[model samples]
Target: MQIRDLPYADPGRPDVRSGPRFLYWLGRNQLGGQLRSLFWGVVHSGSVALFPLAVGMGVAAVVDRSGARLAAAGGLLLLLGALTALGDTMLHRTAVTNWITAAARVQQLLARKTAELGSALTRRVAAGEVVAVSTGDVEKIGWFVEALSRFVAAAFTTLVVCVALLVYQPALGAVVAAGVPLMALAVLPLLPPATKRADEQREKAGRATELASDTVAGLRVLRGIGGEELFLSRYRSASQEVRRAAVRSARMWALIAAVQVVLPGLLMIAVVWYGALLARDGRIGVGELVTVYGVVTFLLFPLRQFEEIAMAYSFSRPSAQRAAKVLALRRTAVPADDVEAVAGDLKGDLYDPATGLLARSGELTAVVVGDPDAAGRLADRLGGHAAEGAGDSPSVLLGGVALDEVPLDVARTAVLVQDKDPVLLSGTLTELLDVPSSGAVTADAALTAARCDDVLASLAQASPDGSGDPLRTRITERGRSLSGGQRQRLTLARSLVTDPEVLVLDEPTSAVDSHTEARVADGVRALRAGRTTVVFSSSPLLLDRADRVVFLREGTVAAVGAHEDLVRSNPVYRAVVTRQTDEEPDKELVESGKSEPIGESA
Candidate 1:
């Protein structure tokens, strides 16, 4: 495929059984492109191999003082030169095409998998690892794909040249052929160590990259805790480890290069030394001896491809394996063929059989769980997330239909699960809120429901003259320019604008002030009065505003009541929400002060 037709119309499903299998699958997918590359590679290497023959013929013609034969040799040299340039040009074009196309195909596969897995992708794979695979790893994989054809053609040319030399002059050919194989095989034993060093280097580099990414992402938090120097020292140590590993790997590769050069030079010397004796004995002509020397010297160029192919495979194999591992991740439940039929029955309640969590339709239900990890798992199950080890877990029911059995598109449209740490993509405020608006929820309405007026005002003040429209204000990557509360509110606004039938929010106001949380809770209740919304929060302000609060203990529902009722009745619920001992109620604090019983201000 040409680079111009990039981003293939359809990057076909890949075979991701193993690294080598994935590489082979890539080759098979682009068979036509690979064949074209092979053809050009053959032409290029063949022309290079024939160069010594043409020079020898010309020398012989000159020695014989034959004008016609000399002219014929000169014409042959020009043809070979033209072929050499053409073949080299075409091979380069084809190889680059293969590189770009292969990278694009892998990129498409990654994108598809990410969409299929959604947030679970990040849970299964490290964000840094995903970033590495999508960027540098993909290029390395493409490098191997592009190099394969050239290596094949070069190896074939080397064999053909060896056979030709043996037929033309056995004594010199035997010596050169034996030395060439020795040169290629000599590096094999060293390859394992070289590969091991390379793996270590890559691992250390990845760790360093991950550390840097985390440090940058949490720079504000680090500064807040006065731990910047500690993290900096740790990163410095990681960077040094990466550096040492890279130096060791480089030394190994350099040794291999030294071997490649030294072996070929020795072979050339052997041919010349042996050919001189043959010439002295009058068994070979000067022109033929020159030809044998030239052939062996030219053969060195193609022989070097062995080293390149080996190195390429060594680096790319692990990258391919990493990519394959990511691609192999599939959602737990197999979606039914008739999604419409399955969804038709789903209309009453959302049920999670795994955790015994249920949300009544058109009600604002709040779930307060003591354990954050269990809370997260409950959220996943409620949203029909592919459970890691429970592929056979009963499907979450929405209405009467199984949520997992519904088509992915329909399920997403029906239920929107906003994680505790929601991400706000880089864009202007207007662009950020301009999602698939369901007409019932406008940008302004959603922003209001999310209590983002203060956030917008802050953005407006950050702009020129403190008069710029907040909608026009630009947000930095992942909204790093904004505070955590501001980013969370903006993400909430975006999700609200989608106006899905069911909205599941996990700790939506954990980062906001109690006053702001109170406003958000009230706004959400007023706006989603007739809609089904499930919020996972322990904050009393949010829970008090919910129509019903479900208290979860030990991964199961322990109590269900109004926030005030639960706080006064259940000691466990009171301890969780108020963080107080289960003694008599704090009547003075609960009745006299709104802020204390409601939640922490910050």
Candidate 2:
């Protein structure tokens, strides 16, 4: 395919069995581009190799004192120069295109895998490692893929030149041919050490990258806890380790480079010295000796390609492996043959047998768990995601069908889970709210329900152009420019716009003020009326609005009743919702409507 037709309709399933296999798969997919690059490379190398011959012929013609022959030699030289320029230009163009397209294909595959895995990807793989693979590793892989064709062309031209020299001038050609191979093979002993050093450097760099990502993601928390200095020192040490490893790797590659240069220089000196002796002894003509010298010198260029290819392969091997590892990740291990499709119109209660938590159909259920970790796990299980390291597949069922057994697309469409810390991707306000929906709610309605009018107003006021339209305002990456409450509301609105059959939100209003949280609770209740909505929270404002509240102690359900009933009857439930110690007497916090605000304790 042409470069313009890139971003393949499908990058096709990659062979992720191994790193080498993945690299091979990438090459096979781009065979057409490789062939085109190879053709141009051959043209360029062939034209360059013929230059020395043209010069030798010109010298011979000048010596013969024949004007006609000199004129013919000059014309040949001019033609060769033009062909060299044309071939070299096309060769470079095609090679760069091959590199870009290969990198693009790899990036596309990674993106697809990420979308398939969703949040589970970060759990299986480090966020920093993913970032490194997508950025630096992709470029390294592309370098190796594009280098292969050029190396082949260079090797082919070198072989043909050696054979031609051997036939035309046996005495000098023998020395040239024999020394050429020695020059190419001289650096073989150093490749292993160089590759090893490179791998070490890559490993260190990945760790450093991961550390930096973690530091930045939790920078605010670190600042609040006065732990920023501790993390910074830790990251500094990691950065130094990476620097040292890089130096070690560079030294090894430099040694290999020195060998490549020294061997080629020695071969050129031998050819020039021996050819001069032959010419002096009447064994070869001056014209022939010049040709031998020029040919040996020109051969050095192609010989260097060997060293380049070796270096490229050493660096790219590890990169391809990392990419393969990420691509091999699976969200769930359900076999393709075992998948069963769910009816499009199916709707029922969402149940998780692992914890005996159930949300009846067409009801608002609030789940209160004493342990935050257990609450998070329940949220995941509610959406059919098994807890990490769990032995069996998630037993969460909807409409009498196991979620793991049903197709992933169907499972996701049936249940939407918004975690405690939902991320807001950077984009215009309009683009952020545009997502797959059931045609039941409009963007404006969702925004209003989530109480995001203030968020929009602030964004518009901050706009450089002073545009009052909030939809035209832009958000920074991860919504770092916005406050926690603003980001949470925007995320909530995006989730609301989807209008999924079952919506599970974990502490959706944890970042907002009491007034905003109360309004959000009401907005959610009104918007999600008659729909299966499961909220995992202990906020009195939110719990009071729930039609039914299920309380959990040590994972299993301990009590189920209305918010007021549980507060007065269940002491454990009261302690969790009121944020009070069990030994502390409950003063009926929910009843008095004097619940502590989020991030505060009694």
Candidate 3:
């Protein structure tokens, strides 16, 4: 088939597959090209078998004292030899191209599936498995695709040589025809076990790859908690387990190799023994026997490809399964709706069923969630980044329209949630703030609102991207080179630039000091005038900025009122603000409520 005809097959096409099926489909994908290559390969194989005869013929003609005629025959033999070489080159080139194309097609399918899955992919498949599929399995898929034509060509080549010998001299021909079957059949019995072990080895390798990826991604956190050595030990154990599985697999393949060697040796013995009888009986010419021997010798190499194809299948099958699993993943969190408009303006309030909290529009609301886990889930749900059914997940609504029902891009454009720990990409200060749907804001207004004028000054001092200009300088990966507060302020500035209809701030001021956080709260409230803003924080400074503050008990709103009103009426709200506990006297807790937990003490 033409490259254009390599239709997009489902990435999940392969099952707990054997390698042959994968190649079968791969060959099916490019049948036209492969069929042509197979025809050419056969022609080349036939030429290869005949070229040996030209040498023997020239030698015999010289021995028979027909030098002039033999010399002319010699020129003809040389020309045939050159043509044979050219055919072999074309056959090999086409076969390799077929392999690469097949691999590329599978890779394209895998990429499409990955895009469809997004972040949900890692949850379903190990990172290492994904890596292994891309690295090793892809090549194997190609091998199977490219091997089909060669296998076909090789089979016919064996047959063609067998017929040529029979026509040239029956005695020698019979020996080759009979012996070649023995060589091929010998490996058949050993195949089942060989393939099984190869598959086992491949699986163990994939697991090992997954383990390594997990260990690396969390290495920093493990070190921070003094668990680095423990994780290292676990990874070492995993590595050893993979090693053992690999060794067992290697043993099985080695046994197959032994069969491969022994079977061909016996075939050679049978052929030589029969040929000796033919030569002594004068039933076959010495040159005819020599050519037959040469053909069989060449045939052995292609037969070995059968072993290679089996091995390639063993490696590729597991890889295809891993890729298939990734392709099967759907970003279920995003809604399927085709939104007509993102939002001219965010209407009504944001309500989360999981937490029974309502964030009213045109108001600064503080949600003091008692359950941190519930709060995080509610945050994800509120942003329409996770699925919500009933109370399975939290829900955020705009004008009573469930956030989950809105199109992803529409939801994103409407509600911008700044998570507690936000990611800062590497780029110029201007580029970093250039997240989707955000553009040149009155940078001064956003900066003044996020209280990031200091960060801008720092960038101006020494730009990481070499511009020494805050708008042009690039940050390092994860903003690792920046301080915690600097990164938080930068992310806030980016969010402010988007100027979404509703802004969700989850502990946006956690990294900064109280005075700076207080300033930021005022700036945000002022900048978000006439817009919806929800801040999740217990800081009295941030709470004071809210037009309404809701105290959460268990997972429901215990009280909803102004910050000062809630403090007077709700004991939980008072205790949280004053950092007081039940262990403290109720009178003291109720009085100032400043007895509540101190900064970072919660």
Model 3 CA lDDT for position 219: 85
Mind sharing the TM-score for model 2? 0.84
Candidate 1, 579: how far from true, in Å? 5.8
Q: How does model 1 score by TM-score?
A: 0.84
**Candidate 3 ranges with C-alpha deviation above 4 Å:** 1-47, 59-63, 68-116, 146-149, 163-175, 178-182, 332-411, 414-417, 438-442, 461-482, 501-504, 529-538, 547-602
Count of residue pairs whose backbone atoms collide, per candidate: 6, 0, 13
Candidate 3 TM-score versus the reference = 0.77
Model 1 gets an lDDT of 0.84
Question: On residues 63-146, what C-alpha lDDT tens digit does candidate 2 reach at each position?
Answer: 988788888888988998888899899888888888999999999999988776666677778898999999999999999998
Clashing pairs for predicted structure model 2, backbone only: none
- Give the lDDT ranking, best first: 2, 1, 3
Q: Candidate 3 on 1-602: residue-level lDDT in tens? A: 44454554443353324444555666776777797788778777777766667766766677678888688768877877786788788788788878777777778777876654334345456788888878788887777667767777878877877787788777767777787777777766766776677677777777777877887888888788998888778778878877887788788878777777777777777777788788889886676666666666777776776677666666666666665555444433433343554354347687876666777778888878765656665666677665322335535677677666665567777887888888987777778766665454567788889998788888777865565677866688999878999899988988888888788888899899988999999999998888888888888899988988877766666677778777766666777777778555467656775443311100
TM-scores of the candidates are 0.84, 0.84, 0.77
Clashing pairs in 1: 346-399, 346-400, 346-401, 347-399, 347-400, 348-399
